[model samples]
Target: MNPLSRIRNFSIIAHIDHGKSTLADCLIQTCGAISEREMTQQVMDTMDIEKERGITIKAQSVRLSYQYQNETYILNLIDTPGHVDFSYEVSRSLASCEGALLVVDASQGVEAQTIANVYIALENNLEILPVLNKIDLPAANPERVIEEIEQTIGLECNQPLCVSAKTRLGIRELLERIIMQVPPPKGDPNAPTKALIYDSWFDNYLGALALVRVKEGAIKKGQRILVMGSNKNHEVLGLLYPHPIKQQQTEEIACGEIGIVILGLKSVTDIAVGDTMTDFKNPTKEAISGFEPAKPFVFAGIYPIETDKFEDLRDALDKLKLNDSSLTYEPETSIALGFGFRIGFLGLLHMEVIKERLEREFDLSLIATAPTVVYRITQTDGSTINIQNPSELPPEQKIAKIEEPYVKATIIVPSEFLGNIITLLNHRRGIQEKMEYLHETRVLLEYLIPTNEIVMDFYDKLKSCTKGYASFDYEPYEYREGDLVKLDVRVAGEIVDALSIIVPKSKSYDRGKELVVAMKEIIPRQLFEVAIQASIGNKIIARETVKSMGKNVTAKCYGGDITRKRKLLEKQKEGKKRMKSIGKVNLPQEAFLAVLKID
Candidate 1:
């Protein structure tokens, strides 16, 4: 067994744009992990979309070597996403680390996402140290932000380190604090070779790469190990530390260290995050605790723009899901959308990321239906069905009751906008659970809201209502009986399953009308009239018509006698009638996409 005493494993957590990636780059540069000449901005944010959006989309691991007090220490850093949607990434990263740096913006102070992440780190028993970032800014106030963190997140701000991540100011001292305060990992190196699989992703050739924290023993190349959660045994094909730019090959990753295990398993399910790995022959009796799989909270339908490219879309999704385990999908077909897949995600941002990645990476244009939540339907025969796609919902007559998922949400906003936020939440059917005033300026509002209510454009609305000063976080709660009905949109008297949504009974009429009006503008006008109708069961709530395109039938009757003009007009009317009776309204890809961005 190899003893590693001078090793530190930690994650840098903060709200978006609070210098998480910048701080990570400084650490890497200072540790000389990568040459200064090669250092690029936001090196940890390797994804092109992440660079463009100015946010970290995925959790990235970087290994560094630091020398302090004449001793070389190994530092393993996992840079996690700051958005609440990606909090699951932070949780899994926390399981692999011994401590975390709770970074708060000196200018903006602590936010909702930071508080949510702090609780997750606490649950993992990770030592958390405070770091006030961006102190070089003119409006920076570390003292006020420290007080806010203590008041809102319940974390002591004693001796909080202030650093300007952009200028590399106080970063050396921050690293010193990490070594002095963050405790060394505690585990038995000689006991049955145990490790925790914190994260995994797929590679084109190497297959699944499991990023692991060696808890009790060393993992070397050619070592046979078993992933307890997946119950699959495979040999470690390669061993390397996770680098930002490239994989740094290592002879072995000993206990108290973090590294990647190349299992070469083709399937993502074969290597589950939070699963435990142990030596095949000397397996441990119990797998690690706190290894629950992340469940999808929001679901939507994804279809290719072209009907003939359905197989291309399916193949792309299969390849994408091989790397994105959080993304779940199944086959689905629609009368209007042709063939596609019903995909589930952690949040709206997750759904967007998946779509963007699919398009940018695979070059496949697609249309995603309006997002929906899983509905639990109890039938008259005492049977239960879980509907992921609204089109799959059972008939209202067969459903004895429908249970809709709810979420316990936390929202933080400036006190001045409290009234506006309250009104907004009320309109969304959110029930106030609790409220607290933090630091006399910001208010923390907790609400119990329907999961389906907030997934669509709630975040965008919340940000707009509060002038981008509000933050929201939520978790799934128990489902309750809801007055829910499936709202269907009919195009030219044909039900378009792609535009169906499960909405509250009370809002069905308004929502149905909204859908009808929105689709009316999206569907193109043809030579024959087309009716866009929105309905609930057999009742029509709203109807609109895409007016027929006019043709100059009379223009053909040139030296027009009154009888000739009349004959041409009558012939045109008959032609329109025949077209309306036989012509099918084939909605284009834009029609299905319109529902996602519609008000």
Candidate 2:
């Protein structure tokens, strides 16, 4: 086992697009973990979706050996996702670290996501080391950004190491600060094994793989360990030091070290994130805390293009869920959309990335319904239910009141666009709580807004209103009581549950009308006239009709009497009416996506 003084565990955190992956590459190169020719751009981002999106979707852990002053030190660096959608991932990564390198963009300074994550690190009671990145850019302003970080985050402003991850400038100095400033991990190696399972996944051949930070005692190969949360005991098949691309086998992983444990279990649910691993014969008195399973904030229905591929999609999801615990799904059936799964996500981008992976990695074409937040419905019998899909909402006669999720949103934008941003938030039923000027040009605004109001296109609208210069961050604030009503869309007199949504009572009529209009545009005209209606209860708020593809049935009776032609046309109308009664609406994929973009 390595001595406590020679081991350091920390994570690198930042806002989205803050060059976290780039900085990680520089660190890996300096440590000589991988050769310069072998290293790729964003080497930690092994997933194709992450590389395409230019974002980190998962937290990666790597052990590096650095020699300084003739002393060898072990550095365990846990790289975390920076997007707001994966903030929970950041929290889990921080739980396993002793400190964090708070990377700030030298050109952009502190952003909405950066401030949110810093608070999380502070809550973990870890030391914060601020590092200014992107100093090689022509527009880089290190001094101004450091000042902004101090003023915005209230951190002591002084000389922070300035480095260019792209050019590898000032990297050696930064590495020196890491050893000099970041504290080594502290734990008792003599104690019983109480390792924190911050991350876990499934391997096709290895069964369940868990990544843990050993808090106390040691775990050796072939040792029996118990998962505290699941109460499942498995003999450790192997222990591994997690390298970025390749893993190294080890005999025993002692306390204060990060390692992976192989458990020969098939099910992913058998292993839980945040659960502790302890000796089977002698267990720890207490399990690790502060790691909660990520609760999904966005919900949508995903259906395969072909019903025969349902099993394939399920298998793919099972495999994906092995790696992603934030993703939650269950069997769901829709009258309009048929059988599907109702999946939950942390945010919009998270949902997008998951869908993309399913299609790209799993080779399946899937359709996702409009996203909705979980709503609490109080029934007349005094029972409450938390519902994700709008179609799951109770009937009006049974519902006493409806409550929707809300978030405390923080927005950073130019002062010139403050008025426009305020108006947009007000329309979404936001109540302003605080507003402050960070600089002469930039302002920070905080507001309490309904989660449903912003899950769809709030960010896009905010950016559009500010000319793409605004940044946004939000977390689940509370479930507030509101007069929420379900708006159901009916095509050809059949309610399409997949397109249903819970909207504010005041704006239900307008929203219902807008959806009807949008559906009318996306749904192609059929052989029979289709009636598109948006309704709440028995009240029809809006209506549109897709005229049938007309055919000249009367043309067959050319040169016949006008009355004879009229009689033929009347017969055709009767046939069309009968077809409309039995005809089903086969909505295209575009129709499902259009509903999500409604204002």
Model 1 ranges with Cα > 4 A deviation: 556-564
Candidate 2 local lDDT, 104-216, one digit each (tens): 98988788988999999999988898998998888898877877888999888577888889889998898878888889888888888999988888778888889999988
- For residue 284, model 2's alpha carbon misses the true position, in angstroms, by 1.8
Model 1 per-residue lDDT tens digits across residues 1-599: 22567898999988888889999998999888888788899999878989999898779998888889998888899999988778888888998898999988899998878888889999889999999999999999887898898888788877989999899899999999999989889988778888888788888888889898988878878989988887878998899888987788887889898899988888878888888999998898888888888899898888888788888888888888777788888888877777889898998889999999999898888888888888899999999999888877877789899999999998989999999999999989999999998878889999999998898888889999999999888888899999888888888888887788888889888877777787788788899999999888888889999999999988766685799899888998999999998989867666776666655
**TM-score for each prediction?**
0.96, 0.97
Cα lDDT of all candidates, in order?
0.87, 0.88
Give the lDDT of residue 333 in candidate 1.
83
Query: In model 2, how large is the Cα lDDT of residue 399?
Result: 92
Q: Point out the worst 10-residue segment of candidate 2 by lDDT.
A: 552-561
Candidate whose lDDT is highest: 2
Candidate 1 root-mean-square deviation in Å: 1.7
Error of 1 at 337 (Å): 1.4
Off by over 4 Å in 2: 556-560
